[model samples]
Target: MFTFEAEFFPDLTKTSVSEFCGEELSVLLHTLRRNGQLIEQLWNLVEQNGAIKLYCIAPEEDALEPRHFNRYGLEALSAVLQKSVRPPVFRVIGKTVGLSDACACENSEYYVLFSNFAAEYSPVSCGDCNLPVPLYKLPGENEDEFYALRQWQGEYKACDSLFVLSGVGEKFGYREISEVDSSLTRDGCDVCREMSQKCNRPFYYFLHRHISPLETCPRCGQEWGLDEKLHGFYAFKCDHCRLLSDSP
Candidate 1:
């Protein structure tokens, strides 16, 4: 059985709690606190089965320490444990319960459980790019959430450029542009000329320079390999997809 010891007023912030427990758990806790029946059921389980133990260091007025366990915090934690689906050995250490041993299972076992939970709960795709996006949540109004949101938003902004580039060649009835060819100077080619006219700007102006020559094939999602032709020009080809793009 997995064991967890949560201090009522840890030095960590609410954001840290969310990171430790994960976004799904944090959200579930938020949802459960709003419902009377669920919260009562959770407290009953904690009281009856020793599934959760509650303790307080010292109560203070006018200071809201995000780390400390309050009613909402307990409710959130209970909800998370219930939803985690794995059997957990929990004990609320109060003045009476006395200290108990840490979990009996090895650290590796806990790692596997949490890893499986994240994989099953994480989001499949980003909302903007439709690329894979990890499941994430902002649990509190804290700097941590601010930074996480900024990082996530930055990725979506970067994907906008990638999405445009990925569709450019196809939009012009040209073969999917290899990263190598796209990086080359756009001084020649009817495709570039047409693209310039369509965008009302030089095609190379919008091309991303950081694109790697070795890229995944748009058709088959397989790695593109370098191919040398008799004409001395280099090409990128994917054997699985039969997709080929000659270097300019």
Candidate 2:
């Protein structure tokens, strides 16, 4: 048997409680835990309104579902609600600027963190070459900019970061005009060419001003740039022996 602690705003109206049961509630809880101001406000709200007893239960171990894995267990329910519900209950909560809305706004501000994580960690491969491609959505690009890029490219691919893509382009000689002209292609890689054509600039132009420091091999002290290949896995190829190792 397992027991979990559940907490809720005591003065929540029935409607608010119902709304909180799904995605809004999960987003709110995550925001509250992350934002210090919201946590203080939550404590103050509880102190003024008094605590409400919702329910208590201990379920048998065999009866537990996958959703129960999280300490709060609300996230699993929230995921289901987000799919079925339209516009999300949290949008309404945001408009009200109430206790819940404050937390939601904070959560919205940090949503890009998740986007960055997805860009870096998600499995991505080039459609034409079938090789793993490093793609990134640069920070400060809003949803509108993302959509505009997709529209310009005439196809949609799930890359958010431009820096990683630029790095890949530089390594493959795709962004160099001389190489493109010699090869009779605008870019070396199909993916790089598509992005360069859409942006009206060479892919290498997106490379960060400061290059990443070359990693030094522990065994031989050889320096090399990290490269991604074959389904987005990373490997460092030693400059000395051309040996490939997973770690530098």
C-alpha lDDT score of every prediction, in listed order: 0.30, 0.29
Candidate 2 on 1-248: residue-level lDDT in tens?
12223334422433344445434544544432221112211221122233322222122221123332333334533443443322221101112122111111211111100112122121222223322222221223222323333232221122223323665544433222212132312212343334444433333211111233225643356674565642243344443432233332
TM-score of each model, in listed order:
0.18, 0.17
Residue pairs whose backbone atoms clash in candidate 2:
136-160, 136-161, 136-162, 137-160, 137-161
Per-residue C-alpha lDDT of model 1 across residues 1-248, encoded as one tens digit per residue: 01123322211323343343345444434333232111111222122232233222211121112333445555565655544434333343333232211221211110100111112121122212322222121112222222322332233334444445556433321211223243221222233343334333332111222244435655566766474541233245454433344344
Alpha carbon deviation, residue 167, candidate 1 (Å): 34
Q: Pairing residues by index, what is the TM-score of model 1?
A: 0.18
RMSD (Å) per prediction: 19.1, 18.2
**171, model 2: CA deviation in Å?**
18
